[model samples]
Target: MIELITATQLDYFDNLYIEMKGDAVERDDYIVAETKRGFEMLRVVKSNYRVPKDNIVEPDGRFVRLATDEDVKAFDKNDGMARESLSFCKEAVVEEKLDMQLVNAKYTLDRKKLIFNFTADERVDFRNLVRILANRFKTRIELRQIGVRDEAKYLGGIGPCGRAHCCSTFLGDFVPVSIQMAKNQDLSLSPTKISGACGRLMCCLNYEDEYYEDAREQMPDVGQTIDTPDGRAVVIGMNILDLVVKVKYKDDYIREYHCDELNAVGEV
Candidate 1:
């Protein structure tokens, strides 16, 4: 697997999977390259971007050797230009009264293309806006409309967990999340409580789902009838994390017992 820099101090691009030959590339090697977007300078990364054998995609271009001092200077200049281009795009959006929120911008390493990212509630007519930016930058201009989740992934911030967002830091691609996952885990259905910064179900829900699912299948659920050492009882509560069930006896006494201690008679 070949690696490429996904982000820089000011710009964020999806980590690209490149196909390179021989031992010419190594981790942290800076090189000029052409990507699907345009010409770019990407550094090799240690982690691989894996793909299924059936639908593997090829790299845009081959690595063009390790970077030089001149390449470093060129990248620095491009970085500064990208920031300025973002500012310019924002002003243009305002002037045109476009229904869009500009997110970020990037300039290709060869300065032949400028890409702008934005989010909007609905489709935006950006034909005129593109012409404005094209004349200003004197290059091919692309305005990409993305979803809220993608916007969050691009401009990251602290999550509800008081740490960096998973999307920006480590998540390579987003997986499907559903509210039922929360219900299965017995979480509060409150949207504000369960949703993430992306305003979708917290991705962490998928992390331990298998464990909860297996435990639920193997154990009796709350409100189910069960036979306990004390007597016939109804399950009152549960701690899935601890693999324990709290039961209320016919005498109205409640006791927590290991899952194995209770024999399931029937579900509620």
Candidate 2:
């Protein structure tokens, strides 16, 4: 069966794979479907492989089906249905362009829908630009404003950790992330350190945030003055996973102890 994995928007993010109940084709292979996000070629593998099924991976939810080429073509024919667009503001090195990276160039198949995908630092004024594209395409047009992460998904690049970009590779939706998650994980506050190419906090930070929170609750705060092996001292640092705390006792003297040695903590 041809499954359709549509992005909530054409942000070039991963889309969900739908395994519709009572599906006619229960094949051992996965089929490809086209959404505004591009194309998804998914195949079914042995459940014993232990790879997550459906949207359990992240940003879950997509519509699966047995789609025919005719179905895709007809949807594309609706000019305004599937196309997204972006209008150029000021003249650039290329041409008057909107804030979009051209993933595909040239119009084919009678210009089904003119979809504009762009990222803007501030609210843009592009009424006249839209008018220009509408007249040029002679069909319906759509403009999609995406975040920095979406652009990374559209362009496809390697991440700082030497892995494929997560937004495009597996993630579908941009789950909420906060700096607090970073703080809980003890990540650097620098934007470049924690933020992804999308200029937003990395999605990974949320993975262990709850664990950190739970761990923190079981132990004393880092700055609290607590009794330790060396002596009564103030906690200078902590390791949540190791359940260890560093206490500062005397001049330039610090000691590390597991939570098991911890005693009643005094006020900082």
RMSD of 1: 4.2
* Model 1, span 1-268: residue lDDT tens: 5545555221222233223323355667777766677767777654344556784555546555567888889989988999999998899999999999998988888888888999999999999999999999899999899888888888999988899888777675678888888877889999998898889888888888888888888668778888877777898898888889899987788898887666443321
lDDT of 1 at 70: 88
Tens digit per residue, CA lDDT, model 2, 1-268: 1222223122211232443333433334433444443334333322112234563333223434555575446445533333333223223303555444444222222354456566677666567666776676576555566667777777677888889777766565678999999888777899999988777888888878888998888778877887765567888898888888888886868888888777433332
Off by over 4 Å in 1: 3-5, 8-21, 24-31, 43-61, 263-268
- TM-score of each candidate? 0.85, 0.62
**Where does candidate 2 have its weakest 10-residue lDDT segment?**
4-13
How good is model 2 by TM-score?
0.62
Clashes of each: 0, 17
Residue pairs with backbone overlap in model 1: none
**How much lDDT does candidate 1 score?**
0.77
Q: In angstroms, give how far residue 77 of model 2 lies from its true place.
A: 14
Residue 177 error, candidate 2, Å: 1.9
lDDT against the true structure, per candidate, is 0.77, 0.57
